[model samples]
Target: MLKIDSIKFDDEKMDNDRLNNYIKKSEDAVEIFVDLLKMDGQEEVVGMIALDNDHRLIGVLELMRGGDTFQKIGTDDLFYLALRLDADSIILAQSKADGLKVSKEDYQFNEFLIEEADKFRINIHDNLIISGRDYISIS
Candidate 1:
């Protein structure tokens, strides 16, 4: 059996006030993700923003964490949470502890995510790579 863990959000640990201000823009998405992840000298982490039909914040999911080089996220694993939350759209994000440049792997991953998202009737609004004090949107 391929067991998927139950997704949970630690409300107390998240900056809900800052997150609520995000309005689906790439910049706002980056701000919210940076605040949530606080990727200061830390390893790479993958996260997702779940949104309702109106683009309101549903919640955030921290999907995977890996060393400096890479982090892996599976479409099936991500969509499981989206389905559970009944989300209409999702914004994907990953911390690039190295810098703000988008790697070939990043491009391929976002491409795969977009194709996979369509099958579930979910819109992938954007994919952001956050670095020190900057970000790049590969939507």
Candidate 2:
């Protein structure tokens, strides 16, 4: 049998200034991708930005990483994290090393996310496709 004890750390409240400043628009999301993701690589990646009810960012999660062309996002896993983080809404983003167009699959996935989020009462703010220095909002 394995027993696990809870670990604790000092709590500190931080201002939401940085997140509020950076995530104002779809283009800002592209800037976040450029800074956070290793876009020079050949692999495709899917990530989410969790936000509170006020649209202030809570955190960013990288959900899936796959080959240059394909990455599948698990809706259950995505929302599970959101609930764990106590997020009220989320922005979905994917990287395409080849181009900046939102694929049909991406659109379908966003629709699926919207449907599932409704069931959970979570908001799906936007879906973005990022490639190099550019991005497209498919919301």
Candidate 3:
């Protein structure tokens, strides 16, 4: 059996904020990632923004952290997290410190995710490349 721990945003060691809106668009997903996942714009960080069927926030998980090159995401852990969260969909994000442009590897990974997510019956909303304070949706 696998047990997952829950962390409250208001926990003493962590800051908290109230989000009153559902993630209706790519920009909404970008806002959540930028505010919560502070990428230094120096390393490659890949994460998933899990959303419920109503498009409301469920949770965010940093799936993999890599240096300045592409890193393969672990589908086992990724799918497990999504299933545990009961996520209806997820938005994939990666940090490209050099620029906000999507790389060929990015597209390939996105394509691979789409196929994997389909098998899991989870939707892939978008694939975003985040660089510094800017982001572009590659999906």
lDDT of all the models against the reference?
0.71, 0.67, 0.72
Candidate 1 overall Cα lDDT vs. reference? 0.71
Report the C-alpha lDDT of model 3 over 1-139, residue by residue, as the tens digit: 1122343333222222334336667766666666666664677887788878877667887776777434565776787788898989988788866777766877887788888898999998877888876788877
lDDT of model 3 at position 46: 77
Q: Which parts of model 2 are misplaced by more than 4 Å?
A: 1-22, 68-71
lDDT of 2 by residue, 56-125 (tens): 6667777777764334456787888888878898887778767776668878877877999998888988
Instruction: State the lDDT at 129 in candidate 3.
Output: 88
Candidate 1 lDDT by residue in tens digits, 53-126: 87766777777777643344558878988888877998887786576777788788788788998898899877
Cα deviation at 62, candidate 1, in Å, is 0.7
RMSD of 1: 6.1
Number of the top TM-score candidate: 3
TM-score of each: 0.78, 0.76, 0.79
lDDT of 2 at 52: 80
In lDDT terms, how accurate is model 3? 0.72
For candidate 1, the TM-score is 0.78
| Location of the lowest summed lDDT over 10 successive residues in candidate 1 | 1-10
